[model samples]
Target: MTYSQERNKKMHSLLYKQRVLLEHTGKSSVFISNDSHKYYTNLLEYIEGDLERNIYTIPVLRKAIKTDSYEHLLKVVQFFSSNTSCLFDVKYCYELENMEYEDIQADEYTNYILYGTEPVTANGSEIEDFNPKYLSFYCIINMD
Candidate 1:
């Protein structure tokens, strides 16, 4: 089978598994099994390194994320997808700071304490904080 075909097959399998898990748990989102998460994390790390070097594209990256076999796959995919150019740029490592943790408490009595505030925007307004320098690099390669 071709590379594209293999990727498609993997994506399909992942989606199927996610659907089954959701149905069984009655949850709308995907939830990876503990063992699956550990297994997939190692796989994802390798794939992500390749992606950073521009050895992969959006579709291939999407397949990798879809086939993650872990709950963290969605977040990993989003992070890489959002910064495709960063793969080639070694100077800028993608970072997400101050992410709000998802609520897991089963009790209904506790009020949800919103931990993080959403960024707001005003018409024709700009906000800039330049403490952390951000840079990305890319290179042209000829495959012959």
Candidate 2:
């Protein structure tokens, strides 16, 4: 198949998997699995010199949070699909049954949290200390 055709097929599969995950979990948002850490690390290493970035650094994160977490995942997939030869996959996307917030944050896949908070406008008012809950996203990026 052509590159575009293959990308489209992968995108379709991603959407289907996300839909199934939403239905099974009864949650409006879905995140990539934590098991995909190495892939993300590899992606960061390819994009930057080190794994110093996280999902929040993505330019689309702010916009994605305004909608739903799943939207962020879609945008991320679309970005890699259109811009690079990397194959992004969420085959390991699954809920962490007993993981703690601290544990999740410390995970190599999500260790990219900024130490400071930025003022965020909420309900038409600017909240100085708005700490919004973030959904973790992890996916495999097979650089071809």
Candidate 3:
């Protein structure tokens, strides 16, 4: 399948379900109260001008972590699944050096790492990387 086709499939499959969406593109989902929109928007706009846009968005992303719980984060992704703005693409973060997918699937200790994504996990040879921004969250705002 073409890239777009696969992307569409992934979005369709995940968005409809009560799950989180993370892709190889390093885009992930995040949810925040409507009141927090301004703050998030400003941060995103500022980071857009930075050379290391992804790296700098870490602070914003961290704030999101505190704002949305693991379960709610997944729900947010589902809410914006069809939102073209919220691709819910995840950014690369850390990885489980020695942990296997099967091992961590049920491990409560690795809950943070498994917050988002289904078929895609820190399992296999995937290196977990920091997903600093909610690309999908941008969809909720008007991009000038």
Model 3: per-residue Cα lDDT over 41-91, one tens digit each: 433334333313223223354454344444543443333333543433433
User: Who is ahead in lDDT, 2 or 3?
Assistant: 2
Provide the TM-score for each candidate, comma-separated.
Answer: 0.25, 0.30, 0.29
What digit string (tens of lDDT, one per residue) describes model 2 on residues 1-144? 987666556555644453454344333223334443323333333433222222333334333233344544455454444333234433211123374222222232222344343322222233333333433445453433
**lDDT per residue (tens digit) for residues 1-144 in model 1:** 987666555545543443443345433223335444543344344453343233443335345545533335534433322332122211112122473212122121111123322221222122234122221111221111
Candidate 3, backbone clash total:
16
lDDT, residue 90, model 2: 31
Off by over 4 Å in 2: 27-56, 67-144
**Candidate that would win on lDDT:** 2
Local distance difference test values of all predictions, in order: 0.33, 0.37, 0.36
Give the candidate order by descending lDDT.
Answer: 2, 3, 1
lDDT, residue 5, model 2: 66
